[model samples]
Target: MRIKLENGKQNELISLAKRNLTWKELAEKLNVSEYYLRTDLFYEKRLLNSEIFTKLSKIIESDFSKFIKLKLEDNWGQKSGGKKSSGRLKKVLKPEKSEELAELIGIILGD
Candidate 1:
């Protein structure tokens, strides 16, 4: 799941985080990169992992959930939907017999 906060709330979260702790400190505590928090999550306001939001919510002592919009990442387009390969293997084994095997078969029949 991903979390996307409202426009105003985006800046609010950043201010709260800055007041409570250093940006680097917050990133370290949350086990994420500052680049991700600032660039994608805050500035670009892109959908980010809900796990990060949950952890940040705790540190900032705020419930940003009300403004949040959840986006579920799915591979619907990429889903195989049981069509993995070209289906069952070909049963044309006769054509694959070695020349020696064919000769042996003819010898056995006295051909």
Candidate 2:
């Protein structure tokens, strides 16, 4: 069965997987190569088979159905409108200032 996920669901899955196990560990548990998991599955957004999904759900301790997105026949081939542009000016941070701010945060958090 072909399963489709929301645009960012792949990234979210990777993040959740990482919290419980390292990429290498996860690959070992899934019985796939780490490179395949990182490149083909995570980065390339490959459609996973049900067996893989079941293993993943077991490892992550969450239902995989939550990430599955269902599309009706009418909208099956349609592409979603991509992320909207914020169109707002934002401040850029300098490296030195960013480091200083990080140091201040560290100091405050240590207190």
Candidate 3:
């Protein structure tokens, strides 16, 4: 499962992990791409998977995993299809409107 640490703690952990190594060198040790390590994890931060987080903890000898917590993210994905207008709108609705509808139609028909 993907996990997240508190942002402050995660940044502290990343700083510790960096130590003297450049991101490219650190990524090489972790067998991942520097772009992913730098951009994905370091810059555009998101949930890190268990294995990667474990590796980082081991590499830095720092465990911030306890700071991690699960949240039910309702905003995680997109919702499709929604009411495009203010509902039934100013259009035909009930059978009682048929007389008004016919009058309106007659006006359009040039009657």
Candidate 4:
């Protein structure tokens, strides 16, 4: 239940949020207030509790740390480690593509 942030999860969360669920819906599903969700999404607050983080992980069907790291990376635009692989491929993914990818992630997660 200890949800430590990781790179993979953060990406997944962004993908999920962008594609499958709005931050409001996600917040409702997670049983947290919208203010907190915005804080978590916009203000870069790390979700520390295992229960809440676990709920989100379950919804996304991903590990908590990976999701957290993704959130951090998306919000902060900071690299997780060495070099980012996606340079040109990322350009190919337009807004629609991102939405599709997010949907796929949600489907895989069974949401």
Q: Which candidate comes out best when scored by lDDT?
A: 3
- Name every residue pair that clashes in candidate 2: none
lDDT of 3 by residue, 1-111 (tens): 567677666666667888989988888877889888877777527666667778889988866768887532443323222333436457666666688889998999999
Best-to-worst order by TM-score is: 3, 1, 2, 4
Q: Which ten-residue region of model 1 has the weakest summed lDDT?
A: 73-82
lDDT of 2 by residue, 1-111 (tens): 445667777666666776868889988888888988888788745666556667777767888687788523333334332233345558997666687788898999994
TM-score of 2: 0.54
Q: Candidate 4, overall lDDT?
A: 0.57
**Distance from true location, Cα of 44 in model 3, Å:** 4.7
The clash tally of candidate 1 reads 0
How far residue 51's Cα lies from its native spot in candidate 1, in Å, is 0.8
Which pairs clash (backbone N, Cα, C closer than 3 Å) in model 4? Answer: 6-65, 9-66, 9-67, 10-66, 10-67, 10-69, 10-70, 10-71, 11-70
What TM-score quantifies how close candidate 1 is to the native fold? 0.57
Candidate 3: where are CA atoms >4 Å away? 71-111
Model 2 residue 10 distance off true place after TM-score fit, in angstroms = 2.1
Q: Of the candidates numbered 1 and 4, which has the greater lDDT value?
A: 1
* Residue 32 accuracy (lDDT) in model 1: 81
Native-structure RMSD, model 3 = 9.2
